[model samples]
Target: MDRVRRAARRAMFAEKPAWQRWSLRVLMTLAWPVGAVTETLYYLSVLPPDEIPRRALAWADRGGDMLALAFSRNVPPREYYTYRLHQPDRRAWITACLYAPESYPLLSWLNRRNGADNNTVQDKSRFADLCRRHELPCIATLAVFRDGSQLWPATPFIPALPLLWVKDLSGSRGAGAARWRLDAGHYHNGDKQMTFSPEALARQWLPRDCLVQPCLDNHPALAALSDGTLVDFRVVTGIHRDGWVEVVATLGHLPCGGPSGRRYIVGAIDRNNHCLISPTLSGFQIIKNHPDTGAEITAQPVPFWPAALELVVNAHKKVPEFSRFVFLGWDVAITPEGPLLIETNSGWGAFNHQRGIGAPLGWTCFPDIVAEYLDFSEHGDAACD
Candidate 1:
């Protein structure tokens, strides 16, 4: 009976026309408000007794404003506070929610129109191969594992490196990422040690497809700012209508020691001079010096700034396949040799940009660029909404 019901539902969905399917998706997208309100209530419930009343009052006061923004600007209710949109001055800033692929069908359509069809930037293994083919500066993949079996290095032995970094091939936001260190001829990963042969350990440790690469160190000038992990920069670039690529914004991922060990704080970089400024904790509170190292974040300009910028811009131009992506966020590492490409993001979040700069992108020329690329006339005001 259950199988029959499932089959009927599948057939019903497949029988629907394209327009009806699209409308269903739109309806589902519009339902996020209920989830958003539920999330806000849950957050308030967890607050201390005295804090709940104040926070709840704030939420209530912003109810009208939240609804207006949602209808007019397409900002999700939860993002209103998450991006600090309640501040009158910040009202003009666009929320990251506006570009979420799940919620905004127009942007999703634009992504496909712009060349997302062949986008390999999201897959680590494929991206590495693309970079290598183009002679682009990037970390080389040592080996690949899939389903607890070796898929690369035909001989199937782990590379003999002092340190190695393992990451899910298609994961993001540092999910399922870990570092392995060679200690006493054995690999140590947190509390787990490589007690078996290297081949056996690789199979045991990896349950999903992943890539293994050598762990890199921060350039000496910026080493102190990094609590012991490699710190990378998030460089955003966009291709204009005329086929020229430009750097839009830059942010630094500074590593700091936390109770759990190493964590990162994002800071806005002076686009012109490449100096770190306006560092923040979780995009909320402004921070001055590194909490763990006490190194002044803005003390010195970032090393290899020009080279880093050039690497990404040139990469966009050199790879014709990537030209379809109007915007890309590049994760670049600075090494003694120069800047190395870490990865590329086709759908980068705007939270870091707005929080680091303390302004909405709407106030800048970003909207104009997007509107032009998307050709807003076809979709009318609905695209903006």
Candidate 2:
């Protein structure tokens, strides 16, 4: 069945946008070597034992002791997570996802949920049920498994521009993701359709060990970075008991799309179904030619800032399932309609760029807020536990 579809895709893509068709072909061809190499290095253990840990420690030493040890540097591919207890017996090596009695790993890593903000998404499991009671739609995210043994393959859409993604399902990294198309998956019919609809999306649902998620479009708003691009926002929000949710920081990203698009296009980033921001270009802009396209990063204000915040503030009341945390980061898209959710990540980063970008224009207490969340007052001298 899959064999017949592969043959059909060849015929379908034979006559489409040259850039679109050729780009997908080039991408598929290009990824082969990368996949081969990752298989090589990953199998070969390219990462040194202390490589990630040392980087974390170095970052801590340089950035002051606030978040020093909380962001455990090394995350084992499968097992082995660095564990620090609430009392601090130094860092302990435990299995990943092994939170239990007296373990503070879950909360410790919560502060880093957003790359540029110290916040965490409220767990929606409880909130999902609440939404059910209220007759609201809530989508649950399923993890894409290690083996492609899904009962359903996501019906992906091939975009004219380019889509951004992070693979591995553990963490988001620039090197971790690349553009993928229908060519990557197996299918029933000649599966090279331009866009996969809801029926197709479910038909590919492998629902085994893979992650099953609601279509991001179901959120209030949804749009590709530029008709086809997946470049999106990683926006942070803070909620006060006073019922106002504020956009503390936003990490507008343009993934490795053409170096040109990277320079000019800033996509959406969301914290949850609640809030997100679009690149209205804010204060400054990057004035470089894209390595791929040759466009320049133009400056504009953050789009729908006011409306986005209102959604976040009212999110708990709206979703009710995500009311666990007062703060969180969302990868959002601000469409012609409104703000929408991309997905929710538990461990997010707090800085936009690792090095450059100078100081932020607005308040800089995101880390401070994270420190407060970590119960810094009680820990006293405990490292990032």
Candidate 3:
């Protein structure tokens, strides 16, 4: 089935004419409404029987308002509850579906501009190389594994680090990411153990292509918020036509319970004041303390907040390919020394912004910024060098 889908996609691009390819892309974008409806129904299906009517009514009201808005495209059910779209002024919130590159012709064009591509941001290996070339502070890959073989180090095992993170080269949202602790001269991840050899590790946790990097430790001030898992900040940066870069939104992901639990409490950080506010669990329930440790969520401002923002903004400027993107979502870790770039997402979602701010991005300057990029993509000769 996978091979058939791959071949069909290849033929769609290679056999079809440019016009047909674009028409298909447009058709896919137009099909988003169907997905939205399906998603809405699926969300309702999971709710208790008595709660469905109220939630369904809320969806209808909000879905109608979203359809009525000029900027609103698809009404994501998750965002509806996350942002409390049932309340007034829900039209300004943009759904995650719009972030899909093929959702708009101009977005796709922006992605393909100036030989710039999402690979430089999406692929973990490529992103690390870009950071290395630019001398940016980013998590370094100690070794890489591909096709059941070690691609780096030429050794059977990577030099043991106290902790290591193995993640899919092109994965996102912590999907297919794992943390291994070096214990008793063997790498352990849960009940599974490996002999430090790539082949041995692959048998346990590798996913065809993965990067092994030394796990970063959280800054001491922020350590109490999590159970040893590195909590990172999601900083959204936008680049202007004039070569200026600014942070559009900021949020912190605090891993609650523990690293093994794989749950996070996301909080919105005020980009202007650099203070944490609106801590939420699963994007809906507002909370004031960590569920596992009972630590105050906003007891103190984020440590080295200004420096973290500066690092991401500077790092974004260093990568010219990112200039073509509408906005880059930077996962930055605040270590005791300073901030380090974990990874970047050219196609970052809007859920964190909407959920954290408790309002729609449409209510802010984001739509205008997006419009500026769309106009540039339509008229600009080339992406920034």
Candidate 4:
């Protein structure tokens, strides 16, 4: 519901007159202080009393330097951006404050800025629009794409593309991605075809603001007609003080569950080390075939590991603002001879499957790569490379 609501807001906002929407935005920005005050009162009830100031200071530091207005000072008034969340470590900094410091959300750019297609693409509305504008095969993503058992409706903007990619906005263990083939009759499964009219597919199953991707048709391109499972690449990168990027690890995946026209995905993480975790099975274990249908499982290790490397190097220049931040992870998709961004992430999880799949063992031998490209290092190319 949340994801859908947000997308609806984006559609409405996008259609509104520029000055009218901007004016409303300005009004909302001004009213944020009221919400912050209520938040502070809630914290006051929880804290001991003495640690409030100390806790607020810690968040003030982390909510991004050059503090937001209403809190920019030597003492730093409790700004809404950095002082509201009262994060895990933030609450600890204060001796008695009940609140974990909140993040100051003074800057709207972080929430609105655009990024590559393959990185953790969360702005379902923004990115979908970009793909439509550029005529690229992409997916429309929503931040809260789905919640538990409910899926948001499809807010597709383009009919020109035949492929639509839907991703659950909440997570990535390959948990949220789904592929949809919009053709005349209905969705095509591995061996079976379940037919549904276009009307029902939109009103009934599809999630709100999904990245409706045009299927990577391998027919004309590959010379042989094979409807193989599409694959995506992940390249985690970070910026060094010197501003050069390094590549951490590129993990490739082939779907296991097979696109059911709507829900469910079964895929394996191909960690470059000769290890391929079967998407048919969960975790590090590999399954040879689909559990229900017994279809044989197969995969193709990325033959052009070096070309995948070049794409990562080029990303830093492509997104100048994304250069900051301590971490960024992306699932890069292959197109023709190069790569197209599938999604980007600020909080890419540290999963064992990922390391086993092909991550650097301990950053000792691969220090330079992880720092700039993988976005894992506190130190960028400055120290390692």
Q: Pick out the ten consecutive residues of candidate 1 with the lowest summed lDDT.
A: 1-10
Please, what are the lDDT tens digits per residue for candidate 4 over residues 1-385? Answer: 1121122223334434788876766775576566555554554444434434467765355344313322332112232222333455433222211111111110111223233233324554444454445444443433223332233233442233455555544345544455556566565423434444555554433345333345553212321112256555566664555766665444444444434432222233444532234342334344565444454444334444456556555554344545544336666665565555565665443332233332222332223322232212232211111
TM-score of each: 0.82, 0.42, 0.77, 0.45
Q: Candidate 4: where are CA atoms >4 Å away?
A: 1-121, 127-163, 168-177, 182-195, 203-207, 218-227, 257-281, 286-304, 357-361, 364-385
lDDT, candidate 2, equals 0.37
- Candidate 2 worst ten-residue window by lDDT: 78-87
Candidate 3: which stretches are off by over 4 Å? 1-78, 89-106, 154-157, 191-199, 202-207, 375-385
Predicted structure 3, TM vs. truth: 0.77
* Pairs of colliding residues, candidate 1: 93-360
Q: What tens-digit string does per-residue lDDT give for candidate 3 at 1-385? A: 1121122222333335778876875886687677666656565456444435566667576456544431244345654544545445653434422322322333334455434576778788888888888888888788877776677767655356777887888878876788877667667774364345534554554346888888888889887788678988998887766767878777888887654455778877876666678888876667898888888888867888988888888887766766767678899998888899899986566656666766555555455555554323343322221
Candidate 1: C-alpha RMSD to true structure equals 7.2
Off by over 4 Å in 1: 1-20, 29-33, 39-60, 94-107, 147-149, 191-197, 205-207, 258-262, 378-385
Candidate 2 deviates by what RMSD? Answer: 18.7
Name the lDDT of candidate 4.
0.41
In order, the Cα lDDT scores of the candidates are 0.68, 0.37, 0.66, 0.41
Tell how far residue 246 is off in model 4, in angstroms. Answer: 0.3
Cα lDDT of model 2 by residue, 89-189, tens digit? 42232211221211123333442332222222333333333444554433433334334454222544222212222233334443233333333442222
